[model samples]
Target: MSDIDLSEAVWWKSRQSAVNGNCVEVARLPGQKLAVRDSKDRSGPVLIFSGSEWAAFVAGVKGGDFDL
Candidate 1:
């Protein structure tokens, strides 16, 4: 949250990402958190999440919980 420093965060996109540059980048922050941003716009908005939150999201993804 407010305690995490993102200025020096090193963001990286997934190797699985396609070459079309249509993917998001992620950075591991301090205190078991993560920072996510759009790869197409580095200077755009960012989203932060706690460790548990990220885990749940990943689980949902793998379980197809977000599938429509």
Candidate 2:
């Protein structure tokens, strides 16, 4: 579990999110990290990733690495 404080974190989801709100929200965190959580489960667990990790994930996404 992370010890980061997110009491004042501002979160946002992609503009392309579905109408049903089944999407994830992301927040910028301290020390170049990021926090991600399910939009439907605001009080649930959060996933944290480092800047490099997030960049790699974004690159992979743009490269269609996760394409079905």
Candidate 3:
């Protein structure tokens, strides 16, 4: 993966996100990849993950895999 020009990236918040303001933004990059960052700090380091990887994480979340 090369450098990503996040400045042009359009981030989308999750639909399931509560109205409590605890939301994250995801940007679609080239080459079937995605960049995720905290909505509170857009300038923070992003956690880049592949589309498949993100899907798996979502599945895990829906399956109660990360329930504390």
Give the per-residue lDDT digits (tens) of candidate 1, residues 1-68. 56666789999998999898999999999878899999999988889999999999999999999999
Model 1 residue 49 CA deviation in Å: 0.2
Sort by lDDT, best first: what order?
2, 1, 3
- Candidate 2 ranges beyond 4 A from true positions: none
CA-RMSD of model 2: 0.9
Candidate 2: tens digits of C-alpha lDDT, residues 1-54: 458999889999999999898999999999999999999999999999999999
Candidates' C-alpha lDDT: 0.92, 0.95, 0.87
Runs off by more than 4 Å, candidate 3 = 16-20
TM-score of 1: 0.89
Candidate 2: 10-residue stretch with minimal lDDT: 1-10
lDDT of 3 by residue, 10-51 (tens): 999979987876788999998788999888888878988998
